[model samples]
Target chain A: MKQKIRIGSGAGFSGDRIEPALILAEKGELDYLVLECLAERTIALAQKEKLANPELGYDPLLEKRLIGLLPLLARKKIRLITNMGAANPIAAAKKVREMLVKAGLNLKIATVTGDDVLEKLDLNELSLEGNKAIKNYPEIISANAYLGHEGILEALQNEAQIIITGRVADPSLFLAPMIHEFGWDTQNFDLLGKGTVIGHLMECAGQITGGYFADPLKKPVPGMETLGHPFADIFPDGKAIISKVNGTGGVVNLQTVKEQLLYEVINPFQYLTPDVAADFTTVKLHDLQNDRVEIRDGTGNKRPETLKVSIGYLAYFKGEGEISYAGTGAFERAKLAEEIIVKRIGNQFSEFRTDLLGINSLHKSTFGQDTIPYEIRLRVAGKARSIEDAKLIGEEVEALYTNGPAAGGGVIKRASEIIGIVSVLMNRKKINTQVTYL
Target chain B: MKLLEIAHSRAGDKGNISTLSLIPYEEKNYQLLCEKVSIEKVAAHLKNIANGKIERFELPHISSLLFVCHDALETGVTTSLALDSHGKTLSSALLEMEI
Candidate 1:
């Protein structure tokens, strides 16, 4: 008899919708549910929160997600894996324990820590961005290595019902269970590579579905508002089928799968996660009509010698302001408003830019025909050394209503500190992982 | 004809680089994409936004072309002051290229 496991993706990012995950838990009949919530700069901001309050630092919506899915997951006997423990896995695990007690469930939870390699990071190492020494960077906030599946595999071996981790590579969260359930060899690069292909495809829940694929007249998607996330049915032979829950709002086909296969990927022949150098070149996707796609033949080479570390540091404060102009001369008025801000405070900030919302904000450069519109919104933003200096850029833009342009209404302004992220490769031997049962 | 007529795209980011995937509506168009959508043309197309090198990779089986535009997303999503710091719209711009 062929053994198979069903895995569903709940939340794709930190701020993704809760309903899709609830739908998955309620209907997907999943063996494992994985929620990947961390982004590149998410933990650095969380580290700041942890510094302010010791009990803080996890995903803001972790409690809500558990409250929504725990009972359903418990009833279905679905194991859950998440990287929602952004900067503090221990604290996150404790919170989950409290939630389990409150829900009257006796699920064993585990926390995978030691992704925080801040102390272990060699300051002399060069950053992948500019090749600058780590010590030369400004006030460092967080340094986390992209951990593989070892810690997660350990948690599964300990019979954990729920595993929470910080800084585990997104694909690894999905790949760990395949290794645990199938008892696949650790050095089985081909199997791990196949698993990684599945992980990367499912990592963004709605992406492999129709969420990111719709174009007005060209490509049409059915139920975007109620778009259901995706799931995979895996076999012991390293083959998987990608699909979404039936009666959902999205389409799952070869197109969606292919788009996501290359999502955030540079080299398809060598997609390097912490686990394996997955080769998407040999992968084949067959759309089995009615929302089922069969994925086959994906393999990988040996894993990278070093793991990539995401280091966050306090960069600068960004101040921005936007105001609208209307009527026949709206374009000229918006242009004048932009000029006023530049002349007033351009020299105060290190970097500054102005964009007319409908005109050139996205591309930052003009493309297509130049036509004067009835309404245009002028946005002025700048990078400042300090918060106070950052505020000046917005202030100047807001002043245009009374001081510079006519009908510059709907003024909005904001200033926030920026946390910049850089990467450096560290020896995989240096990352000391620990898994603790909660 | 606009590349958008026969193909679709999605933009992705890692650090300062932007990755844009161009998949044709029909597999037959893959050859046209290979001939028209050269790295030089893409670099020229995104010259203003991405002031860096552009590399292209071909996926013959899938009939897709992946463009890795280096130094494209300003400094990065977190640090870049651009409204579209992730360069999510870069793919749309790529689709606007002539086929």
Candidate 2:
């Protein structure tokens, strides 16, 4: 009899840096371990690296993390799936193999690619649909598709304990085994969509369980140190429970599960998928027992005729400077200082763009939040299309220390310029994903 | 068959929405959607049944539609949907998406 398994990937904050998540599979107790090391900025970071090294689009930091765990995974022999490879899975796989060989651990790794149709695409032919206010750029920095769990199935078939991929749609890491184990077919679109929805719920590991959804009211899941990974227990009949590493501090109850289910769905029922669109809105969330929720009623739907392309490029050459203005009129003074400096900087180097971000959304997002009155600091940043333009803009902001306004004002303290970037805007399309698997 | 189901899902911590994956219409039915069906009719039907204010997102590339019933988020249930009061149309609605 095929046994049911529950596995969760590991992710935690260690002081100033984040530790790798794949380590949870090393416990010798998990069927699958998911790692989410890539974010929007991380995508841009990989693109920046590719500019320096043509074949280095995949983030090396994530690769370094994955490589470090090979020996432990091999020793324990755990099967896995991950989207650590940002753009090119093959290139990323080579790096992983190199790391494995260096560490004296031999492991089979597979790459899933062909998700990025951004470069060869013509934006004129695509539609933003109802989503407006989004801008499109002339060039693409990085474009990749969301390959579903098919890669994991192939890896398991080849006895590969670890599967590395460019950008497998997040849900497939959790759904692959279920499909393979249940003998579900590609034509079984409805069930496949359900499994995909289940995978989507657990992919974020912590976000769905309790890490992000813990109500601000209750004494939420405490002691996040040694946070547990997320896993699912799927039955042959088509229902599952999402859980995390045992004894891990988190709850997988109704609120948590529903939150996960809703994450990233622009629409509840017509949720698009590479394999099949899932009717997530129709689904039911049942608190089956302790720390468990049963999600049902999701009907499989058709995927969008277009694939979403996440494009990135240069925003400009940007520089940042931070400073403090204490006492009675600190906020007002800071606001004025920002406006004057921006206008002055614009006057100084008219060819660039200036963006000023303060701690309002960061420090505290809502009312009733109290920031120290006298400690308010005014920070300024400038970005331009050209390096010289950016430099001139930077010089303009720095000029505040000398001839600019607030130079000798009370608490006109500190500042510095930051590096700028050329921002890339992405457009999406729906086409039959073409792949020649080797 | 062309169908769109609009509902919300979580993206991260705060409630971000999710897209419900619906089965799409077929090859020969392309011209029929624009000529026969109207976005207003679908939006009206969904708005009447759903709980919260219906949020609608239209599409491009194809002449299809995405009608989301935005008002359902407040009900606080594991699963929720507002079925149209006219019960005879469900089979036709499923046929629209070709489910």
Candidate 3:
């Protein structure tokens, strides 16, 4: 007899409070909880941490989330998988061990990270040691081979109540537990695809359930402050019922699910991943009514030929500083402030670039930013191969508010550290993913 | 040669990062991607177009890139991404990057 597994998705995995996600997992009688954190810039941050200290660069959020979660989950006996170990799972796991023990929750945790070491692999041709097609570059700030779902499953089988990973594929966290609980074979492409899609839909947590939906979600059910992280209830047949933590602030509805489905999907007919690219278009979703959507008919196809690697490099110099103006004509004055700063900074620095980011521009998001607001918040950020050059930028930017037309009208914020930017020279290399339980 | 459109994205606090994938007409044409792309160069080029710092990230996959493309944000994309040797509309340039 196969075990039944349920799936849920929501956001807010990290923050001061995250109990709602855990509370839902407990209520739903779910066997697994998967969290997705870590993206491109995160990879860069992880790389920075790795360079600073290989022992600890993973997402700090997971640890905090686990403290609130581990005890409750240990009570439920639900297993978990997360890629929150942004750069170094081994280090993060060390912290997790302490948390579990401190929480008085006895549990085994598996921390997976060898992929972060790709930075040390010598790929003269840009081929990531694990991916054979990407071009290798002379320098990389961070590099990690996307791990497959099997790793997560292995951890679960080893009685690892909690699994902390550096950077497992986003969908793999949800699917791995499905593969484990249902005893689904890796060769079962159809079932694998079903699980993968479920994971994909839920990977963003609340994103699927109205977090980023084009439509609106239902009002206050439970756990609003929790921001609604997700959990899954999986059936042996590979069908999942997605939901969020109860009492959360956000709502999960049909539109939310649809929006997440369309995310990052290149070809609905050929959704690609090293594990298996399933045709999501073939899948069907039914409202099924009453806070549940039944996912069915997900067809699995051939796996994409390539695996992805996050290539990051130390920025030679990076800095962030902002200038703000208020009152009438303040916006124009703010605009001039940017030009004057850039012009003055340019006088002393060559190969320097400046950005005039407006708080309004940021608030509008992916659309027109200047439609409203007479006051503007400007941020001047740039990078250079030299730290010395970067410092000059901060000085010139400050000069604008003190000596320029907007003199003293602008408030300067603390500056950001100048860091070098790394680019990926495509490198594809082959990695032996075969792992044995330790 | 078959043309396939690809979409790539990354996620973070601001939200999920995405880009309209313009599949190269064929795989062999991928060589040109390297010719036209370099980290420092992409950063500089994006700055020229958006006049803002472009936060770029490398995506892992058989052959996919997940970029934030902070400034390239525009409406329902109207312009096709590929261009020709002389800077004409790209008719084809990627079978698969590696066939």
Candidate 2 chain A: worst 10 consecutive residues by lDDT?
A: A415-424
lDDT of 1 by residue, A1-438 (tens): 339999999988999989999999999999999999999999999999999999999999999888988899889999999999999988999998899899898899999999999999999989999899999999999999999999999999899999999999999998999999998997999999999999999999998889988776988999899999999999987899999999999999878988999999988889998899999988888889999999998899999989999999999999999999889988988888888788888787888988899889998655675776678998888988899988887787777767967878999999999999999999999989999998
TM-score, candidate 3, is 0.72
TM-scores, all candidates, are 0.98, 0.69, 0.72
Q: Candidate 2's residue-wise lDDT over A202-259, tens digit each?
A: 7667766577655334326654665555667777655777665556666777656654
Ranking by DockQ: 1, 2, 3
Chain A alone, TM-score for each of the models?
0.98, 0.79, 0.82
Instruction: Write the number of the candidate with greater DockQ, choosing between 1 and 3.
Output: 1
**Model 1, residue A254: C-alpha shift (Å):** 1.3
Judging by TM-score against the true structure, name the best candidate.
1
Local distance difference test scores for all models: 0.90, 0.52, 0.55
Docking level for model 2: incorrect
Candidate 3: regions farther than 4 A off: A7-17, A47-54, A117-122, A127-139, A214-226, A347-372, A407-410, A413-429, A433-438, B1-99
Alpha-carbon lDDT of model 1: 0.90
